[model samples]
Target chain A: MGTITVEKANELFWLGRYAERVYTTLREFFIGFDRMIEAEEAYIEYCKIVDVPNVYESKREFLEKYPFDTENPDSILSNLYRAYDNALVLRDEIHTETLSYIQLSIYDMKKARVSIAPLIEMQKVIDNLLAFWGSVDDKVDEEKTRSIIKLGRRVERIDLYLRFRMSCDKLKTEKNKLEKRIVRTGLKYDESKLCELSSMIDSGEILLNQAIALIESLVEV
Target chain B: MEQLYKQSEVVNDLLARYGVKFGIYKNGNFKEQLFPFDAIPRVITKEEFNYLERGLSQRVRALNCFLKDIYAEKKIVKDGVLPEEFLYASSGYLAECESIMPPKGIYSHISGIDLVQSKDGTWYVLEDNLRVPSGASYPMIARELCRRSSPGTFMENKVCDNRNYASLLKQVMDYSNTGGINVIMTPGRYNAAYFEHSYLAEKTGSVLVCGSDLFVEGDHLYYRDYTGKKIQVGAVYRRISDEYLDPMTFKEESVIGVPNIMKVYKKGNVALINAPGNGIADDKGIYYFVPKMIQYYLGEESVLNNASTYLPFYQKDMEYVLENFDKLVIKDVAEAGGYGVVFGSSFTKEKKEDFIELLKREPRRFIAQEVIDFIDIDIMEGDQQVPRKADLRAFVLTGEDTYVWKSGLTRFSRNPDSFIVNSSQGGGFKDTWVLSQ
Candidate 1:
């Protein structure tokens, strides 16, 4: 076995982030989709919450395009493709069975044509992503590799939770996981900035803009 | 075999699920295409496999000896067994590799020798791929999937288990290891054979690295890891071509090459699998001399025969080629992967005349071969079994000893009338079953 190079580390980190981004956003898309069926403009609010441009004319259009659009950089398919691109290079470190989940998700997203059917079809995507995480934890033997990937996953989850306005407690749990992985991986980070972000989150004085900035700046991997 | 054919669709689905694909560039855009797998395997009886084993081993050993001799003593050239002009005129003969002996004195550690069986049951060697030969993983993984699809078929048949190709590969790498970790160096994921590179690395417990992941420092090759730790690389199974291996030595424009890697290799600090400059032996022009090489180096009759070949470089052979222009297949020595091959019968009268003129003007640039009427194998086309042109690529590994993998890659052309069966030429592959009894 070879030591993970800095370039590989960056890829692993981004792989985790993109995989989690697809999973979390797909779940969020389901909720937005259900609401969009009742109101045509509900998806615009959802796009605003996720910080993506509300390019679609209506909620129905957003539901039709967001999950499978290749052109939209923030679409579920794009994130899944990015996840696959990153995982493809790390096959030596990541088990194939684990990587297969991401591949299946990409395939499912591409095959999905009926707009509403994909909202339910994405359940397989969710299952695969969860299985992918479990496989990473169980199958990956390298400490640094697992830690680096988990760090990316947790950081992306925290960013998504904050943007989607999940409970502060949930955000805290995700942040705590990220912090542990950061320490375990021994990746360089701004320790003071991390502590300041934690204090602001704990004290309930955190501005959304400032917290997002701090989270983005926490790790440079 | 019937059960395997019945379950072909399911097996193909599984292959796609596992992402068994090869990438190709079309109009300068990269596209990954699934390498279709045919359920009906090409069965080789134990007796036939034994013959192939000996022939492939003997042929590869002679080629290795030829490489070592040409690089060191030039004895074959001096003894008049091989012409000095042929040795020097070939572009594959790297001058920089002169007098530098690789670890274990092995040049072609892994050889993929392409062969075709004629209708008369005679096996003829078609080409020798000594440099970064691929397609072993295709059959290796195909067998895995096939066995899973029909366990009863495998149980009923006394076929040699080919799952040990990974272990065999590991052994070769281990035998060639001079010091540190073994690594499979790739240009990147975009290369045509990137899947094989990564799959072999995963199976052999070697690191799969790109050029930037590796560097040479103080006469040793090292792999830089994510945490900024450097691991020394003892042996490298580099998948890139010779000209793109080391930027400082060969192609200076290659961004995929590790600088000064040849320096580390030259100093004997690291082992390069199928050591560089092996293209000299695999060159199409040099192929005409392999049987002679076996006779000269091993002092034995060649077990395998080269396809009936005529070198245009020789005056008598050139005359024969000219007379038999409409029946022979002419090949450019510089090209491979089923390229640069022209069947004389397929050409127009004017085109044939033009090709003959080119051959006459530059006799050293081409070789002509009698078109062998190779046997066709049955492959499932929809629900019907059809015969298609196919060829086997037998892999020979040289380590502490020379060993030929029992099973080989059987690639068949999908087009019924097409003779070319390279994957790059839209051919699909079948599992080669070498029966134990």
Candidate 2:
């Protein structure tokens, strides 16, 4: 019932972004993992797509260490922890039932090893994230806070989709949702940059490097 | 109750799902661990609870009056009921809090009075926790899950619902509130009792805030929202200790405290739950004088007895403690959460002599007590039920009137040999059920 603080808004937005990142990246990691089983260089491509430095010595090392590694700042576990850290602070805005999903995801991530069984176990992370977002929409009554978090989620999703070379149509839909949330939140952003990004997204002549730069600069808050 | 015990795993799983945990620093790293819940409820008969409620209420009232008198007239000291030297020498007595009356003349709006029952079934007050007492939410949420797990069990029993603790807390806040919204101020999520801080805020419908979320402007406390909207704060149920409450007043290096907020509290523009400087009354050394305080302030004999305690500051007690060093439990007055406690018998002869030397060197810093042979409650460990040392922390709330919550947090040591039952000491909790009958 209280207005979200600037610090809290930042946390909620990043909570959405990091949780979405973990969800999307873990799903994508499986695809890359399957390919890596066939050819080890498939991980290099995956690293390039996510823009994380290839730190592991071999594909086996990457598969074994990447998902659960706390040292790797861009690992799914790290992202999940970030999401939890952000969500923990926003317990007032987010319902306990909703926050519990994030907590469960983190707990499962800790339990998950580099074993083949965990590849299937990772689906629970995605399931929990979906449940988390659903619970947020239903349980969080504050429209602005929800919109801000959704905006963060949409932005992160669009960024990941573009980088991962997902379908253009999916990117456009997500970008459109992001645009609407950006407007709904009423937070300040570069209107011209958003329009420019929109034009580039629409023309399909969008250079990945240039588009990533524009997306990064799109929202300041 | 048997049905509930059978569903212990289910209740614990639900607790895990709800993030029911407490944070602790282990090996210099902050870790959050589940405060394990035992299925067996600590059931208190209605008659026993009635007696406890009255006694707890009276004790807390006397403590509150003592705080008021200490800050204002010092009548009890002047009347020779309590020594002035003992009052001023206490580390908990804040000079800045003198003559400052809290809203509605209430101090310690929430009091966690720890009591242990002897084998003979007579209860004795172990200690008073007037400063930032926690653990209420543990039992409160546990009861919620227990009822859900076995609805028929609850229906069959005459248990008084403990779900109203939050509402009762809210009522106290509202009663003592000068104006505006109630806020629960936590140090942060890293603090030991962070779960309780956030849970109580959600239950009471108060804004849960850290020190950074609040600021003092124009001598009134205000909470800043994400949208940069400033809302005036009426009551603050701060979970941080007094020393870290206001950096400007107590600890200047405390970054977790809001600067000038104590100014606001002093001005009566905002109400602070369990007003600042309450530690003076709850200090272990001062605990020896509580019964005297009851008689001095309330003009009535204490219904509950204190664990036979001896303050080393008194020459007679010091001599007695030195002579009986091997039989008493020596406690450092300033420490809490089961720390700074030493069983004299556990110390070697050399160590006992060293401790005796330290006690003589700083007599005021310690107190010795005849350790009560406290009663144990049954806890379901795996398939077997075992008796473990447990203690009740009965919460007493004072606002317009002093009242005790019928249900309390019953914490027990997981180790069969340990007497310490603090959550920080790797203890677990059980839901306390006060029979409505």
Candidate 3:
């Protein structure tokens, strides 16, 4: 129940979004990387399913640019940078020990960038991101702060799950978690939109775009 | 000590892992760089530290008295101990702060005094930084990691634990609280010392906030939380400068400053640590009279030495400065961070003449001092230990009384030829150990 300003709330919310973005995207990138070995143009299907622009000209270009290119807004490195941008400002709330894992993730990403065996290096990046979330859960003592971050995490996972056309059961589980966590955050949110999104998931045939829009605009921070 | 030095890389890697860095701006782009750590500490014996503790306390006390006098009675100026021109001409002097009594009448709650030791073992005060002094956290955190890196070095040595800085700081803020919560207001995360600001806030248990997070209402300042709940803030360890602290009172164009917060401060509703208008006491031109200030206010001789400084505004000092122009170092009064400092000997004949002409034209803008060839400390370079120039910034916290921390920040030049040890100028830092024995 510690006091957090509107600005800090915004940072915490986006910190959740960006950290989740980097985590879910990195996990997706690994799967895509495996597919690219057998099928060189497998990333095009990833771009289509994930709703990102296919900017890579070839399999070689996709492998080099997908996770490492900072210029590409959809790249994993860009998402990690965004996560760092939000976490850097929230050091007082997140605590340094919690934030250092994010710092380590960036360093791991930089190592992956110049790294000869990048996929091997990227495995550490994923490990650091996982450690970051574990630290966030263990170190952040305040209930409201923890709840907001979890809400953002749950919202993002659902968005990505919807984009990947995940199972109705998987989407419902994330939706149930978000519904339970949102009430604990003390943040202003569109409660009606949450209910509507929940009903759409329960219907078992979700309109993916409308559900993504609902989750993005759910929080008023 | 050898054990600690052997593990320097491990300690540095831990520092980098913990995000121990400072931000710097170059070509309009901001980048954060690790503040390089030198494992070799500058050790001060108990007796030496006792002497420094007394001297630093006296100097800070006199400076505080001068700030009170400058804003109120002008007794130091009236008594002829300090010149009036130096008081008014100082860019730090604020006309708006006249007769505004801060909470508990404490002007400088925290003072960072820069000091250097000459080859002859004589210590001289280089500068007094009263406004938003940083680098305390650098040493504090380094000490923590150093002990973790080599606990035996601390066990074998009698080095005092320097981790009480946060408690000391909390005491200052709590002592000055006007009946509400404490907060550390920063410009944002892009500031050069943002790491220190956030770290201190975490350590001291104060909320770290930017300008937009706070507001003034009915002569009181309040912090608005995310849920729109208003919490009154009693003490603010503000890291922003005076001009950017209150947009209504200072620069009208500053978006990073709270509007009319000064009105709340003036009303004695909240305390601003190292209260506004302290720049007047720490001005370089006013530094010439610090010895006289100690004599006038405390009726005691200054235990610390001011590095044989001469102001060209005085007829006698001007003649001596002109005669010994090439042997002295000239510093611009308005600039800091090692920017406006120059060695007279480094100037060419034509450039020296032009500089002398400029100095003569604007005598009040600069102060000339005899260069103190300070002693060099050993820092590990590659494999061999080499001597490098270093300076110590001793932090003094004034609350119910003046208390100087036993440990300080010891910064050294990474380049062997340079004397500028500012972090912004590519300098590295070491922990200062005051031996308990």
Most lDDT-accurate candidate: 3
TM-scores, each model vs. reference: 0.98, 0.97, 0.99
* Candidate that beats the other on TM-score, 2 or 3, i.e. the better one: 3
Ranking by DockQ: 1, 3, 2
What's the true lDDT of residue A114 in model 3?
Answer: 84
lDDT tens per residue, model 2, B89-125: 9998999999999999999999999999999999999
Which stretches in model 1 have alpha-carbon errors above 4 Å? A114-116
Stretches off by above 4 angstroms in model 3 are none
DockQ winner: 1
What DockQ does each prediction reach against the true complex? 0.75, 0.63, 0.73
lDDT by candidate, in order shown: 0.89, 0.89, 0.91
Tens digits of per-residue lDDT, candidate 2, A124-144, equal 878889999999999888788
C-alpha lDDT of residue B324 in model 2? 85
How far does residue B228 in candidate 3 sit from its true spot (Å)? Answer: 1.0
lDDT of 1 by residue, B330-365 (tens): 899999999999998999988888888898898988
Candidates' chain B TM-scores in the order shown: 0.99, 0.98, 0.99
Q: Write the per-residue lDDT of candidate 3 for residues B275-391, one digit (tens) a residue.
A: 999999889999889999999999999999999999999989989998998899999999989999999899999999999999999999999999999999999987779999999
* Candidate 2 residue runs with Cα over 4 Å from true position: none
